[model samples]
Target: MPKLMNVRVTTMDAELEFAIQQTTTGKQLFDQVVKTIGLREVWFFGLQYVDSKGDLTWIKLYKKNEPNNCAGQIMQKLFQPNELEIYPTKVMSQDVKKENPLQFKFRAKFYPEDVAEELIQDITLRLFYLQVKNAILSDEIYCPPETSVLLASYAVQARHGDYDKTTHAPGFLSNDRLLPQRVLDQHKMSKDEWESSITTWWNEHKGMPREDAMMEYLKIAQDLEMYGVNYFEIKNKKGTELWLGVDALGVNIYEKDDKLTPKIGFPWSEIRNISFNDKKFIIKPIDKKAPDFVFFAARIKINKRILALCMGNHELYMRRRKPDTIDVQQMKAQAREEKIAKQQQREKLQLEIAARERAERKYQEFEERLKAMTEDLAKREQDLQNAEDKIRALEEQVKLQQQAREELEARQNELQEMMIRLEESKNLEAAERQKLEDEIRAKQEEVKRIQTEIEIKNEHTRRLEMEVEEARQKKEEANRQLLAVSTTPQHHHVEENDHDENDDLPNGDVTKDLEIDSSIVDPVEERRTLAEKNERLQDQLKALKQDLAQSLDETKETAMDKIHRENVRVGRDKYKTLREIRKGNTKRRVDQFENM
Candidate 1:
């Protein structure tokens, strides 16, 4: 029986354990984690583990040859152990308990080239947010103090809804680690001051959704100098310590002191091959004229990790060049639908919460007033009983009349307010309707214009077609006439010196010959005229065909434009209808409140 190994993979929020064969490849384990998380954009993530050397390494989730055949097989063979297979001997730690399961962290190993455009899935974005937040807090990525404060505010908003004064008092962030220790150490302000600055920014994101807040955080984080770069401490050929960085674009070498800027860069497109043996790594450029990049790591384990990262980054770079697969398309569509649904749900929930809070406040106020009025009435009744009972009755009647007048005035004011709001809503609705109508009319006019133009082009095309056909027929007829003129036999006159031929011919024949000679036309001149006319007809036919083709192309473009406009108009109408429905619901709610 094969041995079953208990492997634990830690994600952003939770740890997942899986029982697999001891010989399970990295690809299988990675796939299991992705399936468990329901992550569609798997390209941006990788499973990270601490090797025996205490260096972080990415698990090779795919075969090297899977990306391309050029250098894949060679690299695959060079990095033995089946691309860092899951083995107890490789990952076991001396101080750790033997009974504990093998641990791995599922993390965002790569970032999108463009966050807003490429990062589509909410789940993917959330994972990135969690990883980036941890990095920022841990000082793994260097963030300026100002930018760190801004990121911390977004983090706070994402974690705890909005910053409430009652809940988030002083020392709220003191216990929680928001910014890096370095950032705090550099600033002279107290912790309270930093919290206040963060709260100021947090207040501005009051109603922002958690996903939006997270997205905003990522957008800012992506701009930092060390955002998505994975840095490895290594030595150059000169024995100088340097940092080798690998990111989505390419590999970069940073100086020993400065991590913000790179000393040299090699884009993935320029790189032809990457191979390493022992602690020696080399990067060959596509341009033979350029020298190869050679660097050395402290341990062979580090070289393996660097190679794995480079391969993965290169594969992703190539993948992005191709079109999206069907699965990707479906995932994008589903993510969009889910995003819209979640937004609607959050809006509805917020609306309900606000309305409930308002009602509760009003009820509390009414109850307090009623309690005070009851106490006053009781005191008055007590005093009246002690004095004149008849006077007490008059006082009660006056109090009742005063209360009625006050209630009437309040009701009138409310009615007036409702009326004003209703009038304003009506005016806004009228303006919106008029605008929509005008837009619809304009669209209709545009459509009609395009249609009219298309019709004109079609008519012109038909006319050109007719002209081309006529010209072709004329050309063919001219060719046939020229052929007939060429084929026609000509009479040959015998010389007068041939006495025998003259004696044999009758005088009538001679007179006939004279008449024939006089009636004969110049065939060469006639043929030349027919040929010229044919050439002219051919030129006209060619011109007509060219005009017809141009008209057809114009007609096609016009039709496409019409279709695009119609789609836009339909989308606008749908949006307007939704807005109207929402307005109607609001009006109904107001009416119900007024009645109550």
Candidate 2:
């Protein structure tokens, strides 16, 4: 029976233990882990473990001497290394006890050039995000102060949903180490000031979803100078310490002091070969004129790691240049669909919230209006009570006036006669008002007729102007043709004159001369006719304008006349009212006599 060995694998959020045979290979363990996690894009991830040499290394998943098939040979030639054969083949040592579980970490080993385009699954992006966040907070990845603040803002938004003034108070960020310590030390800002800046940026991502926030964080993080770079300490041929960075694009060499900028770069396309012997690694250039690049690592294991990284990066670079596989295309489409769905869901929720807010505002306005109407109703109720009291007092006055009313009968009869005269005057005023209204209507009809005639005259004038323009163009063309004819040879002109003098000339020549003369004379005559027509149109337009002015003046005069008539009617009404008042005074005096 094969001895059973325990292995513990750690993921981003969880850890799992596997009991396997001691002779199990790394490929078997990796496949089990990926199967357990249900990860489809297996190329981006690998199992990492610390070797006996105390150096972190990727667990090799393939045997050392796999059959060299056609596809394997092709990959080996392109990447210059059989990357599959480089990893540790055996996962467990025979000397390790079954109770002792070896530890391995599931990590994103490869990074894409573009996160938005290459990372498809939510779980994949989340893994990438967590890894990058860990790298940033641990100071493994360096960031500038402003970029650190912005990235912290995205992390805050992703974790806390959104920035709330009450919940995310001043001391809220004291416990959270969102930015790297180096960045904080470099800026020399207070904790509260840094929190304020982060919150300010966080507020800008108000409605961003958590996944979207994470995506944004990754998008920004990928643009940093050290993004996706795996650095190793190495020495050049000159015995100078330098940094070797292997990334998706190519291999880059940096000075020992400065890691932010690269001193020399060799893109994978320009590199012909990469080989390692002991502690020395050699990089052959594609150009024969350029010298080979050589560097020495501190350990052979480091050189092995560098070689593996170079192989993986070069393979990916070549793969990216080709078209995407079917699985990648499908994943991209699915990711797009999911993104659209989430966006639509967010929009729907926002619209619902907006509508609820609008409804709440309308409800508030209605409540205010109802309150004002209630107050008005109370005021009108008080006024109604006062009106009722005045009605009772008027009833008492009516009873007191009943006794003198009969004694004033003769004065009342005389008042009736005055009222008859007033009625006759009112009838005459009504007749005058009707006559004035009729005259105003007739004048308005005349004004409308004048406006219609003006429109017609304007249209006719426009037609005449168009005809005049056409005639002018024809005259200009005729003048141009006559100038051209006169500029021709003098012999041609003399021949034309001789043709005109000779009556015995051919009929065709005579016809041609007549045609030429007609062409010249017709334009002049037509121009004269058009000029006359234009002049007549101008006069007509002017006369119509004058008529329009006259009509407007008449309309204004009619308005003034109406105003004067209204004033006279008002004066007559006032005079009649005065007469009625005088008669009423006389009647009241007679009633006083009767009362005496």
Candidate 3:
């Protein structure tokens, strides 16, 4: 076999992922570059070969690296660009070898993301055309005619991309806009000749395929993220351009009711008289009447920045155009509608918060009031229990007094009977009387001393007035004293005069004591006197205890109430801060997020 072209193939540059992910043209070019140079080891931009003419021949550009081992031909040439846009930086090509004479360089920058698909279709179709150009000139038929037809279809597909005006293809695959040169290069024609041929073919097939406009429109909206509240601007109906000031805010136009409208940034009345540079122009709304231009606007306020929008719908709107105030007014109406919607949402949330707050306040009030009331009720029930106990003690005293009175009456009746029996024994009875009289004399003397002691105790009680707590204890002791008096010898002596000690007796005392001989003193009366003395002393002690506890409790409660008032002040301040946070009237949360 004849010596094949000796060369080395290599790809060197940045990673292919980013470049391939960019424009489709870049991806296609990368692939072709890989196959033509790397896979085939055909490192040359164009191949050199001898034709069947028995003479060396030069041919036009070729797209593929077909072998020239048989009686075929080889072409040498690479595609060129008609226009060159200048860029600030230079780009080093990926595939550069020391032996290769061609300089791999680029002086133009492109937004590969925005126009990736268009670039891919353009490069692919042009290469297909170049392939056909080579075949027609050199008479190579290795590939079928249907392949050429398909390439032609691809070029046509590219021309009607992004909402085709002539085709019915759907989905992302059909968004191409170009005419492949392969269809015209079958006869070895240049792109100029190929374009003229396409014009002739388009005249034959202009209205044959109807396009789906709505599908394309929706795809465009989705691509732009209109659902995310993006804003834009464009020109108005008249022709005037504020070229430099337009795209600053980076806003967009919105669609409503089958019409394009600009969102009003704020209420116009607040912003109308203000110039574009004024900081107070925050009240702009969207303009919804199909826009002619989209302007990106910004107004600075209080050392902060805010975004604003203006947009146009028609293609003509991008040209030198004047804005529509009428459309702006329409936008105000639209803004009002949007404002009403937002207000309704806010109002719903506000009402829920208010209701919850009211409920919480009411519950707190109820709980506090309940605590106070329950405490009071417990105290009252205790007092009632004390009263009930006192009433029971009083009833017991009355019952004991009644029994004592009945017993005394029975004793008197028995004495009367016994006296009558004594009278029958006249002389002996006289002796008994004499003995009784002597005993009475001794009791009278004892009574005089006891009375003196009582006077002294009463004088002491008068001087020492009981405190409230002491008084309560004193009252209990007094009740005991009154009980004691019911069983006392002193109570029997005086029926009507109960004194304070004998208060438990019936309104009138019934017990009466007879003058008794010391030799025959009744043990019951002696026991009663001792009990009364003990009760009187106990009453005084109880009164002192009651007064002490009441005074202490009152002082402690006063101190606690003062502390509670101070705590309420702190609670109110904390609650106020929480209220502002919930209402979003403060920027605390925003600041927190910014700091993070």
Candidate 4:
């Protein structure tokens, strides 16, 4: 029975886990990876992992492991504890005349519909950052402009996530923190100064949001050394358009869609003769017995130029090795590999130390956050308590105001009743004055009738007096005659008639005296003056009532204003306390975070 080893494969875009038989070659895993990811152009890439020595070495797909290699052996020998990364050995280069590296062409399934532009930009930025990181690590610094752009790309990546080609890429000219850790260490750069410089540049250029700016950075990253190399389109004898790329290794030819399985490869070590004419690129294999020939028709536009460039690159690749250089070259390569392994081990140990430090810092940050949160909660509770107290105070104030309003209303009612009484009194005074005037007029009429009666009586008395005077004269004459005729019998009769007439006159004088006494009345001017005084009193009462009403309104307004001002002052004081507490707590938390 074959035991299976659990292997985790890392690809350019994803990580895959697989279970393979220990007896199998690395090719088995690679084949599965290619199948799972649907990789079409895959030859230029390989699966690699860091050894226990921390040296990153390729997994040889063509070589078979020893029979003793089991799952444990594979784990101990091939895989790292927690790392798996796939790096490219060669990149497919094609005509990019119409292609822009800043722009990403989307594919199906990788990107979701209605995805945010920010997410796409973030991913794009990450890809560029990875490239920049690779360049930095490889020390591929040459062109100043190119290096600056690559560094800028690295800055954007650190701030954002890796880029996915299936999504739209971001714009570039925006990130401010462009100095990556490697660059900082390499140049002994002051992070603050570098950041300030980038900030100034960003401000001047109207910097983009970090995500959207990735596309612009991607364009710059793409223009790095040896990036976007064009592959020549050639026609084989089978009349198929083959994509050909000449690198330091050799000539590589393949179908445009599938690069993992190349149809023909002319390694520099295996080549015998290579030449190109105006219209063709000709190649002859090293083996004389095989007698196989491979010819490529040049591209239509830059055929001669492309052939020339290929010949030049090939010569450079071939010249490195002399006729008898195999054993010496292998020894040199082994020594370099060992040295790289030691360096990698040291770097790994440093990385572990750094990771531990980071963890401690993160833990401290967590503790600070917890403390801050607790303080915030306590402050909130205090605020709530203060708010409740304020509310209670406000309620008490409102109650007092209500009571005051009720009392004021009662007072207002009393004043209103008093005013009503005054009105009634004024009306009564008016009625009394009218009654007195009517009585005065009646008394005057009675007096006038009495005067008329007196005048009539006087006139009658005058007539009587005149008559008496005539009688007196007659009486004197009559007394003389009577004396002469004393014995006449008519004298007794005359005396009796005079007595009756006098008695009637005395009765009339008595009635006239009674009428005169009844005609006299009290002074009317005194009553009139009393009425004027009552009217004046009524006017004064009305004025008093008006003043009282005005006072009530003013008092109410003053009381309300006082209550409102008190409430505002109390609320302001409480709010100020709350703000101070919050500010203190926030400052403490910020300090803790900074220290962490």
Is candidate 3 or 4 superior in lDDT?
4
Per-residue CA lDDT of model 1 for 1-596, tens digit only, reads 98777889999988999987756777778888999988878888877776565656666544322343553233543222454434322222222223457788999887776687678787888899999889888877766555677788889899888888989888887877898876565455677877787788788677778888898789778766577888888886667788888887777666676565554556677677888877888776666665557788997767877887887788778778889889888888888899889978977887677769777776787677567656655655454444444344445655655565565556556555655555566547777757655655565565556556555655655565565555556555555654554342444222244445554555534322322365666343354343574466346445533433332323323332344245345653222422332332323422322232
Candidate 4 per-residue lDDT, tens place, 1-596, comes to 87555666644345567665545555665667667765432333455554335433345444223255343212111111324443322111112111111111111111111122112223333443454444444434222221453345435444543433334133332334344343343342345544443433333222233443444444444433223233566666666666665544455554565322233444555556554544555555455444334445553234544444454445544444435257545645664686477657756665565668777786787677567656655655565555555555555655655565565556556555655555566647777757655655565565555556555655655565565555556545544544544343553332223344434664464211111355555233233443574466346445533433332333333332344245345653222422332332323422322232
Among all windows of 10 consecutive residues in model 1, the one with the lowest summed lDDT is 88-97
What is the lDDT for 87 in model 2? 44
Model 2: CA > 4 A from native: 1-3, 66-76, 79-88, 93-99, 164-172, 186-190, 361-596
Query: How well is each residue in 353-442 modelled by candidate 3, as lDDT tens digits?
Result: 666977778678767756765665565556556656655555565565556556555655655565565556565666787665555455
Ranking by lDDT: 2, 1, 4, 3
Ranking, TM-score, top scorer first: 2, 1, 4, 3
Clashing pairs in 4: 123-162, 123-163, 124-163, 126-162, 127-163, 170-215, 171-212, 171-213, 172-213, 172-216
Task: Please report the TM-score between candidate 4 and the true structure.
Answer: 0.25
* Two-way lDDT contest, 1 vs 2, winner: 2
Q: Give the Cα RMSD of candidate 1.
A: 43.2
Give the backbone clash total of model 3. 54
Scanning candidate 3 in windows of ten residues, the lowest lDDT window is 105-114
Stretches off by above 4 angstroms in model 3 are 1-340, 366-376, 410-426, 429-596
lDDT of 4: 0.44
Better of 3 and 4 by TM-score: 4
TM-score of 1: 0.55
TM-score of 2: 0.58
